[model samples]
Target: MAASARIFSSANFNSHVKNVRFQLPCRNRQRLHLRSRQRVSKLSLGSPNQRFLSLTSFANFSPAQFSVSGGCLDRIFFGTKENSCNWNFAPTRISDGPHGGLFDDEKGPEVTVVVLGWLGSKPKHLRRYVEMYNSKGIHAVTFVASVTDVLWFDLGKKLEERIENLAQELAEWLSNSSNGRDRFLMFHTFSNTGWLAYGSILVNLRDRKDLMEKIKGCVVDSGGDPNLDPKVWAAGFTTALLKKNSSAIYPSPDKSTGPQSGNMENGLKTEPKETFSIEPWMLSTFEKLFSYLLNLPFAKEKLLRIVSCLSTDQPHCPQLYLYSSGDKVIPFQAIESFMEQQRRAGKEVWCFNFGPSPHVDHYRTFPDVYTSKLDSFLKKCLSSVASPMPS
Candidate 1:
């Protein structure tokens, strides 16, 4: 028989080892593509829709299971809701970090990883993140849930409903556990979809003071552009804006326009009310570069009330970013814009830019580099995160 053609993926090229496998995509079940209605924003949600997911929700490595090859699978045990590993074709995120074994000490350093990925990304990706963390002795794990296509669907009611599900799941996961490495960190990918969901996570954590306290830092990768990103729907934006957005002020929409003639800085928000406010797609671009959006976001005046934030509310945490020069889906300057804003706000930013590849494919490229950087980032968060531990 023909040796099943040795097919290699983007990940196989960067690293010598191939542990994770992205299965042949099924029907566009969880849509990443979106269509718009004439008056898109006005639709209403009929009845509450339900997509029930439990620990065993992912059965055959289908949309929600991560298949780890080599010895990586042996190092950790995945306790799913069912008796065995089910493939959701996606990945799963569960808890099992550096604060490993027994929690003899009530407090030391604890880390919670909030995993986010592209819209169509399956559960396997989530599991891979957990597995990588486990390998590092990070004692990190995640609660799993599926996300609705807010960017594409723009179904506010649907988005809200899905957000509640994720929030409830997260709250339940952290409700009784008083483990050490309680500090929280977000592991994200994609652009608008993840951030839209993140907005809800913050809203959900608002009432839970303890969970709020555990949030240490974030590692947002390849996302965060709402209005300024020239990519996404505008795939040719690089050239389109190449004629305009001069990287001077606001990046002129056309080259003829002399470098936007006004104050242009970094550290802005994506609020709907700000004059010349940013849109979500642009925010995604900002997430990929400069670790601060290359340029600032919004204006200084609007940041006072934290009014112009993308979130329906604002989440205050020392946030960081990850970007790459090669990612086509998300531009690199977007990350710079993020850091620029963070620095302006007097917050610190820790960035991890792993080489380059298509959109959010860092792991497939330099898995070791990506893992190493995360290890260091979490290590630094140790002493800093445990201070004034939440009682």
Candidate 2:
């Protein structure tokens, strides 16, 4: 037998191992790389395995890149093409205090405000609420669902899936961080759109006792309307959509809808009857279409069931219902009935009627009263939690 060439030099060993690692599958490659790195550190040019490692090729090895943590996957899945997945969930700092900055180790976060914003909710508007929570030494996370998400899709299934994913993500986030577990959690929901998201989250957390227990309370603003009148909802949807994408969707607004105009404070506008018109023919057409879809045998019933679950499920925490008699979107009668049902069920429910505020305009209409009510409700919820925070 002829003598074979021996290629066991230090240089050869390093190069070969790199090549072999690359040739292996992603998962296996990681394990092998770790093992090989360890073995190389204790280089033994004489050992069989170590010698074999030296000969293996590493020509194709590329370092595995990790996905950026804290980047929102929801945005990528839901946002517009131009800004998709570019969204980040960085908590806006509202205060610096002794309790534990935004997040703490021993006592957990002081509070976590999860705001489920209504359709057409602008980022700046949502930020104001974040600032509010932060001022109170609490952390705020805002999740805004797209209007199209509610209007176009089969909301029952798609919306539930989206919300369930959000719930799972939230649960994981809380579990992963030391500042999460003992934190007092509350949801501030806006309008029926917000309730859809909130209710879906509750449904997902129903069986998750651990996560459910963390919820201290919830605040519902201008929401939980039981009326499933397609025409009413469709009109609201059209107005919101038009308001949001007016220039793009209705370029010549003056000719089309009399130059759409309303309160622009937070995109939560009180529609002026005399100002805008949706082309009576088109309005009637859409109304009829929506009516048919909403009237599907079990559509409205299923939605009511979900809302019922949201009211009765887990933790049984106190809830603050903020609505107005003058709000055309969600009828005052509906709010009264819902609150009455909760009270009859022995739940800690509080109702604040903003006499004439338009839909979602409760805060703008009664700023001082709104803030006071929110402050009181949050304090009550936090005080009730068994976990004591540092004074």
TM-score for candidate 1, residues paired by index: 0.49
Please give the range of 10 consecutive residues that has the lowest summed lDDT in model 2: 22-31
Query: Per-residue CA lDDT of candidate 2, range 336-364, in tens?
Result: 88788788888899778766556676676
Q: Which stretches of candidate 1 lie over 4 Å from their true place?
A: 1-110, 136-148, 151-153, 178-190, 207-209, 228-316, 384-391
CA lDDT of every candidate: 0.41, 0.55
State the RMSD for candidate 1: 18.5
lDDT assessment of candidate 1: 0.41
* Residue 149, candidate 2: alpha-carbon lDDT: 52
Instruction: Give the 10-residue window scoring lowest on summed lDDT in candidate 1.
Output: 31-40
- Candidate with best lDDT: 2
- Deviating ranges (above 4 Å) for candidate 2: 1-108, 155-157, 179-181, 244-274, 279-283, 297-302, 386-391
